[model samples]
Target: MRNVAVVAFPGVQSLDVSGPLDVFAEANRFLLPDEHYRLEVVGLEHGPLRCSNGMTNFADRHFSEVQDGYDLLLVAGGPGLVHQEFADEIYAWRT
Candidate 1:
């Protein structure tokens, strides 16, 4: 099974993460039930991630704690995405 890591950060757009998550969930339910991907929500820190609209999202793991073994790492985009720091962090994690 492929391990998928999704980065959830402050000010991230909900749909950016939810859309792909739903698609992956559905694909796992039907197409790849036997050998599907494992999804994990990772944050910069071990706490709640506040969205742009004030929605709070919890993370399963922290970015610093993440080790090797992930097949995919997705970083959601939003209005706050203009900040390059988050992009740099994501790229660092991906590499």
Candidate 2:
């Protein structure tokens, strides 16, 4: 299976993370088991992330915990994202 990680943080736009993931999930149903995507929501810290719309999303993994490189990495964005600061480790994981 292909590993897909969606990076999320506080005040993230919910759609930015969920929209594309939903599409991939739906497509998985039509693919073979080995070709399916294994989706994971990664966060700065492990726990809950509050979105711009007040929705809570649980992090399947945290930046510090992620070791394996994913087939796809999606960075979720929001109005507040640009104004926030992240640790060097988080950026390193992305690269």
Candidate 3:
């Protein structure tokens, strides 16, 4: 199985995160159980994430909680994303 991590933050564009994930999930339905993509929502911190559209989402795991590496990583973007600040480690993790 492929471990897929979708990174999201406050003010994130919902589609930027959900679109790709939904595609992966839909693809899983046609594949065997063992070949399924394991999708996980990863947040910078724990608790609820309030998006730009005011939708609330809960992350499956926080950055600190992620110990294993993912086969695929997706970062959600939005207008507010440019205004937000994050730790250097978060950027380093992507590399």
lDDT of 1 by residue, 1-95 (tens): 87887778888888877777888888888655658978888886568988887888888888877777688888788797787364466566642
Quote the lDDT for 30 in model 2: 100
Model 2: per-residue lDDT, tens digit, 1-95? 99988889989999999998999999999999999999989888668999999999888977788778889888889999878998787766652
TM-scores of the candidates are 0.82, 0.91, 0.91
lDDT of 2: 0.88
Give the count of colliding residue pairs in each prediction. Answer: 0, 0, 0
Q: Please give the distance, in angstroms, between residue 90's alpha carbon in candidate 1 and its true position after superposition.
A: 6.3
For residues 1-95, could you state the per-residue lDDT of candidate 3 as single tens digits? 99998899888888888898999999999999999999999998679988888888889988888889999988889878777889898877752
